[model samples]
Target chain A: MEIKLSAPITKEKLAALKAGDRVLLTGTVYTARDQAHKRICEALTRGEDAPFELEGAIIYYVGPSPAPPGRPIGSAGPTTSYRMDPYAPALLDLGQAAMIGKGPRNEEVKKAIVRNGAVYFAAIGGAAALISKSVKSAEVIAYDDLGAEAVRRLEVEDMPLIVAIDSRGCDLYERD
Target chain B: MRELDVKEITEAIAGLSKETNVSLSEDVKSRICMMRMKETDEGAKSILETIEKNIKIAGEEDIPLCQDTGLACVFLDIGQDVHLVGGSLKDAVNEGVRRGYTEGYLRKSVVTDPIRRGNTGDNTPARIIYDIVPGDKVTITFAPKGFGSENMSRIAMLPPAAGEEGVKDFIVDAVRQAGGNPCPPVVVGVGIGSTFDGAALMAKKALLLPLDEHHEDPYYAAMEDELLERINKLGVGPQGFGGDTTAIGLRINTAPTHIAGMPVAVNINCHVARHKSVTL
Candidate 1:
C-alpha cells in the first residue's frame, strides 16, 4: 500500500512498516555514499559531532551527477547499500531512523535496524533521472572535498521508495 | 603510414561519451520493451516503466540516465597502418573524458588513488584497451561502466577437467550472488579460457557487442542462449523484486587456455548498458 512518510521518522512509524510496502517519503533527508559514510563513522568514533543532526534523520545513499541548468540535483538515485554495511550500525546507534538505498544489507545492519527501530528503504537502483524529479532543493552540508560523495541536505517531495527492511528485521531480499 | 590527429579522436570520444549516457541503443531499448510486455509482476512492471520513463527524460533533457555516470572505458582497435599524431594517445583520450564529463554535466566518479581516494575532479585516465588490427582506421568503442555492476563481476580459474558445465555453473552463480546489486535485467558477458587477465578483459570486451549479436561459434551461441534462459528463471526479476526477466542478454567469448588451467570471468552490465562507437 502507498504511504507518505516524513523525515525524523519515529519508532511508531517504523514499526508500522513491513518489508515490501511502497512508501513516498517527503521531507528533509541527507545524502551520503561510501566515502561520506566512512568519514561520519570515523568522526563518531572520535566522539565528534556528525556533520548533520543524526537523531531520527534519514540518509539517502547516493552521489548524484552535477545538477543541470536550473535543477536542484541531477540524476539522483540510490547506490548499493552493502558498501555502507561496515558503518551503518554506528549511524543507527546515533538514532538515524531510516536509510534509503538499494541492495541487501548485512546481518549486522539488519539486526541494528530491528534494535534501533529503524527502517531500510530501496529506491529503484537505476532510475536516477526519474527519482531526481522529486528533489526540491539540495545543499552541500559537509565534506565538500569529496565532490559527488559530499554530504548534502536534500528536501524531497514524494520520493518513491520501498521498505526493504522493517523494524522487526524482516527483509525483502530474503527469498521466501 | 596514414596519420590521424589526436584532436579528432578526442572530439569523437567526447561526443560519444555524452550520447551514450543520455540515450539507450535501439537494441537495448527494444529488448527492454519486449521484456516489459511479457512481465507479469506488478512491482517488476512498475520498475520497468520507471526505467523507460527515465530513458525518455534523459534523452529529451540531455541528462545522464543514472546518477553514477560511470568510469569511462575506451576500447581502441588501432590499425597497424595508422600513425597517431599531435599528442599522446592516452592524454587525448583523458582530455576527451574531462571535456565530456564537464560539458555533459556527468558525475566525476574517478579516484586519484585506490587508497588515498581523492576525486580526480574530472573523470580522467579512462580504462583504455588497445588492439592492433590490419586497417587504416582507428575504431573507438566507448562504454561507460558503472561500478554497481562491475563490483559484482567474478573471475575463476578452473581445471581443464571442469569443462563446460563448470563454466555455466560459475556464470549462473555469479548472477545469483549479484541479485539486485548490479540492478536487475542485467547484461552478462562471459569470458572463457586465456590467462586470468585476458579472460577478464574479454569479459568486459564482450559487453561492447550489440545485444542482438550472437556468438559466431554455434556451440557457444547455444550456450549463451541457455545461460540467458537459466538466469531469467532465477526469479531475481527486475530490481530483484522477482519476475520473468532477470537478464536481457549473455555473450561469451573464448580463447585458447594454458594446459594446466582454464580461466573464466563474468562481467555484468546494468540494463542501461550505455555504449557508443566511432571509427576515425
Candidate 2:
C-alpha cells in the first residue's frame, strides 16, 4: 500500500512489508552515501555519537542532486544499498530501525538486521523523477564539503519503496 | 577533414544520455514481456508488470527509469579522418555528461575517489572507451552504469585447453553467484578470448546489444543461447523472486586470445539496462 510523505512510519509498519510491497514514504528521511557512511562508521569505531542520533530513523542511501531554488530537493532517490553494508551494523545498533536503498545486502548486514530488529527497503533503483515528486522539503544537514555525498534531511510524501529484508533476517532477494 | 564543434558534441552527448535511461529499448521491453508471459510466480508476474509500467512511466515522463542514473559511460568509434575543431573530445563528452545528468535531474553517483569521500558534483570524468576507426562518421553509445550490477562483474584468465565450455561454466558460476544483487533478470555480457582487461572492456560493451539478440558468429551465437537457457533454468527469475527467466538475454563477443590462455569476463546488467546509441 502507498504511504504518504512526512507521515510517521513505525517499525511495526515497516515489518509488515514484504519484497516488492510498494510503499510511499513521507516525512523526514535522512540521506547518506559513501563518504558520509565512512564518517558514520568511523564515529562508530571510535565510540562517538553519529552525526545524527539515528534512533528509529530511516537512513536513505542516496546522494541527491542540488535542488533548484524553489524546490526542496532535486530528484532524490535511493542508491544501491549494498555499498553501505560495511557500516550498517553500527548504525543499526544506534537504534536506526529502517534503511532504504537498492539491491541486496551482505551476510553481516542481514545478521545485523535480524539482531537489531531493523529493516531494509528498496527505493526504485532509477526512479528519480518519480521519487522527486515525493520530496516536499530537503536541506543538507552536514558535511557540505562532501558535495552530493553530504548528509541531507528530506521531507517526502508517498515515496515508493519495497521491503528487501525484514527484521527476522528474511532476505526477500534470497528467500521467497 | 571536417571540424566538429564542442557545443554540437556536448549537446549530442547530453541528448543521448537522457534518452538511454528513460527510453527502455524496444528489444528489452518485448523480451521482458515475453518472459513475463512464461513466468509462474504470482509475485514475480506482478513485479514484472510494475517493471513494464515503470518503463512506460519513465518514458512518458522523460525521467530515469531507475534511481541509480549511473555513471556516464561512453563507447566511442571515432573516425581518424575527422578533426575536433574547438575543444578536447573528452572534455566535450564530460561536459555533456555534466549537463545531461544535472539538467535532466539524474543522480550523480560517481565518487571522485573510490576510497575517499564525496562525488565529483556533476557525473564528470566519464568512463570513456574510444576506438579510432576509418571513415568520417562517429558513433557514440552512452550507458549510465550503476554500481549494483557493475560490482558483480568479473573477469578471469583460464588455460586455453579449457576451451569454450570452460568459459561457459565460468560465466554461469558468476551469474549464479551474483544472485539478485545485480538485480535480475540480468543481461549477461560475456567477452571471451581477449586479454583480461579487453575481455572485461567488451563485456560492458556487450550490454549494448539488443535484449534478445545474440552474437552473429554461429559458434558464439550458439554459446549465447546455451548460456541463456542454462541461466534461466537456475530459477533466479526476475528480481530473484524465482521463475523461468533468470537472465533475460546473453551476448558474447569473442576475439583471438593469447596462445596459452583464454581470458573471459562476465558483465551482467540488471533489466533496467539503460543505454542508447547516437551517430554524429
Candidate 3:
C-alpha cells in the first residue's frame, strides 16, 4: 500500500518497508554521487575531517539538476546505488543513519547498515521532477569546484522514498 | 542557398529532447498498460502501477521522467537533394542539445574524455550517426540512452549453425545474468546480422520498433514470442523484485549475414525506455 515517509527515520521504521510500500519523505538530506563520494572516501583516507558531519545524517545518492528561476532544485532523483558500494562501509562506521538511491548495494554496505543502525531509502529512479518539488531549500556544502558532483545541503519537505534495505539485511532486490 | 540556422533546429531539438525526456512514448505507454493487465505477480504489478503513476506525474507536472537524462545520441538521415543553408547541421543539432539539456535542467552526462573522465560542461557532441537516404528529407531520432540500460548491452558472433536457438539462449541468459541491475521488465532488443559491430547497431536499431508491433516474418515473430516466454520463465520479474513479467517487450531486427558466419547482439533497455523521432 502507498505510505508517506519522513527523514531521520529510525531503524525500526525503515525495517518496516517491504517491496510494495510507497513512501513520501521529509526533513534534511545531503546529496552525494561519484565525485562527491570519491572526495569523501579520499578525505577518510587522508585522516582529514570531511566537509559535513557524518553522524546521523541522510546521504542521498544523487547529483541534481540546476535550479531554474524560482525553484529550489532541478530534476532530482536517485542515481544507481552500486557505484557507492565501495565507500559506503566507511560512512556507516561514521554513524550516518540513512542512504537514498536506486539499484542494489553490495553485501558490505548492507552489513554496515545493520551494524551502524542505518537504512537505505529508494526514491523513484526516473521521477526526478516529482522528487525535486519536495525540496524546500538547497545549497552547496563542499567540493565547489566539482561542478554538479559537489556535495550539497538540502532541506526537503515530504520528499518521497521507500526503504530498499533495512538494518536486518532484508534486501528488496534479487539475490540469485 | 538557405542557411540551416541553429535557431529553428535548436528549438526543435530542445523541444524534442524535453518531450522525450519527460513523457513515455505512445508505444511504450500502451505496452505498459498491456503488461499491467497481463502481469501475474502481484508485487511486479504493484511496481508497474508506480511506474504508471510516475509517468502521469511527469507529464502533468512537466518534470523530467528520470533525472539521468542520459548521454545525447542523435541519428540523422539526410537526403541527397537538400543542402543546409545557414549553420552546419551538426552545430545546429549540438546547439539544440545544449539548449535542450540546459533549459530543461537535465543533467550534463556526456563526458569529454574516457580515461580522464571530465564532464563536457554542457551535454554536447551527441553520439551522432548519419545515413544517406533517397529524397530531400531530413529525419532525426533521439535516444536519450540511459546508463542503466546501456551498461548491460552485449554483442557476440556465433557460428552460422548456432542459428536461432543459440540466439534465444544468449538473449535469455543475458537477462538472467543481468538480474536486477538493468532494471526489470526490460525491453530486449536483438540484432542478428554480419560482423560484431553490425550486430550491435542492429540490436540498438531494434529498440526503435513500436513496443506492440511484431516482425512480419512469422519465423522471427515466433522466435520473439518464444524468447519472451522463456524470459518471463526466468523469473527475473519487475525491478528484479520477483514477478512474472521479467520482460515487458521484445523486438528483433535481422539483416542478411556473410556466408561464412552469423553474428548476433542483444541490447537490454530498462522499463523507462525514452526515445523519439523528428522529420525536418
Winning model by TM-score: 1
Deviating ranges (above 4 Å) for candidate 3: A1-5, A10-23, B1-8
lDDT per residue (tens digit) for residues B175-219 in model 1: 999998998889998999899999999999888788898999999
Q: What digit string (tens of lDDT, one per residue) describes model 3 on residues B71-108? A: 88788887777676776778888999999988887778
| Top DockQ model | 1
lDDT of 1 at A173: 86
Q: Write the residue-wise lDDT of candidate 1 on A18-112 in tens digits.
A: 89999999999999999999999889889999999999889999999999899999999889899999999989988899999999999999999
- Which candidate gets the maximum lDDT versus the true structure? 1
DockQ of each: 0.83, 0.41, 0.52
- Order the candidate numbers by lDDT, best to worst: 1, 3, 2
A151 Cα displacement, candidate 3 (Å) = 1.8
The CAPRI quality class of candidate 1 comes to high
lDDT of 3 at A61: 86
Query: In angstroms, how far off is B187's CA in candidate 2?
Result: 1.4
For model 2, how does the per-residue alpha-carbon lDDT over A68-93 read when each residue is reduced to its tens digit?
A: 55667665556667778888888888
